[model samples]
Target: MTSTSARPRLAAGQTTDKDIASFLAHTEPVDALAQDGYLAGHDGRAIAQQLRRPGLVRALTFSVCHSARPDTDRFYQDDEEEAAQWRRRRTQTIRDHCAVCPVRAACAELALRDEDVHGVRGGLPEEKLALRLATDADRLGKARAADDRVERLRSVRLDAEREVHRVALMHTGGSVPAAKRAENNDEVRTAVQERDAAKKAHRTENGWTVAA
Candidate 1:
């Protein structure tokens, strides 16, 4: 069982002076930015300096502090079942903090744009954010990478089907003998089965709706 007490706690109200001070004292701003994949090609010291500005600090999602569970990194790296337990414990803490947070929308938007970012943000987990990212790609004006992946898989399946057909034809005798035809049919059946399985797997991975 997961212990909810391990989650971060936040006091009610606006971004207080105490909140800002506690966040800076307990958390490393640059590390949080780096985890969001926003630190590349940027100097850590410079980012940290910018984060110290009161306005920027107040606007930051992590500035709420309590939304950031200390075990976030560990949570993402653990086995699925263990990670799920951690997520359940952390869920209410995130919800409580985000309910009054000033930057919840911005935080959710950022989470949507970054696929590699893990852990909870704006009351949503990384997995939920990933699904939103995929489903909302067109709405967000991003390229549909999932569509591209499906196209690639379709191509692969077609190639496999073609190869099976080629093998069947290659084994056909001059008179199209029964034994040869039987062998060809078996090979073709196996190939079609393999192709269907691959297509099903691709659809599942990309969350494509299965056709009737």
Candidate 2:
């Protein structure tokens, strides 16, 4: 039931200038978004120009995905048939919107560079984007490096969170009974001291030499 003319004319794993221009022409007018502060200091054309950059564009004021359903529905659900139905609908919606988007190339580029991105972008889903990366050697290498950096940052965040939780538990003396909260003895005192020491050490690591 779809029109052949509406399909994107992209080559395998490629987005040409012509393709970008064609889709960009279909993007929503930015005058209202700009007035509402979504565009901020940048004009629509300026934002469109940045779509060619390798980096993700922070200003997605004109992104078609904004009007679509949330990305979560694309995932498998308790009902297999229902989930498939949703996925098909979501994919079709993405294709329709992306085919006409002026920033489709940029949207796809962002999806390629960042592994954490989800849902439909650049008229394709994450799985399709992954396929594109897998088939391109240079792009695959770049994506691997980006994935490594993302994993490293995530590991650092998890470690910091765990340390914070440990310190909190130490300060609270490991969740003692309510009646025992007021009955602080040697064990509680030792825990408090350990918590304070840990806090001081953390501060020192961050260049806060002066003890509070």
Candidate 3:
């Protein structure tokens, strides 16, 4: 008896731009394929599912970025004079690699989903990607929500500091015992870090900073 795989087969000439886009719509972000963002123990199931989808295999099989430089940070350089040189190189990459890629549509869809935060994806640079996302109503709503969370976290941080101070003042020596002081300090530190993280998240939602 012969055993067969259950994966659906890709139809001939079915890897059109629309097909690629539709395939990516059902898949996760392709950040796992990036240079700086590669993780060792990523959820393989997602990738397996992507491969089993319509056009992902054909779209990425010979894509150019795969053979380009592994260090993707240059794609997100600041717009200084020095960075202009890198920008030119980035433009060349878009022209030479991304422009001719068969998966450009899929890559663009990923970028539109806010997946390609650090560099060029779908032939659009980080700046262009941010501008596009900024115009998206869904992205705007999420950014506003992030801003509110940052404000709330800031208030919690301030309250934590006051509590730390109050606890310290409860002692006649104008400070809590060593053990209690350490605990209070930890609480304040955690609160401050949480606020800072929230601020970072707000920046990410607005595309002001690269998501780590």
Give the whole-model CA lDDT for all candidates, comma-separated.
0.51, 0.48, 0.49
Candidate 1 residue-wise lDDT at 194: 85
Clashing pairs in 1: none
What are the per-residue Cα lDDT tens digits for candidate 3 across 64-177? Answer: 566554455546555575776877888876777666654554455444543454577667787877776677657445534554565565566566666656654554454558
Give the per-residue lDDT digits (tens) of candidate 1, residues 1-212. Answer: 11345433445663664454343323433334434533222232223322322223334534444455444353344556575687666675665565455444445554554444477665567777788777777644432344355557777778877877787677755788888788888888888888788778665544332231
Off by over 4 Å in 2: 1-55, 66-84, 140-212
| lDDT of prediction 2 | 0.48
Candidate order (lDDT): 1, 3, 2
Clashing pairs in 3: none
Indicate whether candidate 1 or candidate 3 has the larger lDDT.
1
Mind sharing the TM-score for model 2? 0.35
94-211, model 2: which lDDT tens digit per residue?
6566665544655665556554336666666768777865665485465456445544554555565565565555436557876655544444555566556655544333222222
lDDT of 3 at 84: 68
Taking every candidate in turn, the Cα RMSD to the unseen true structure, in Å, is 19.8, 16.5, 14.1
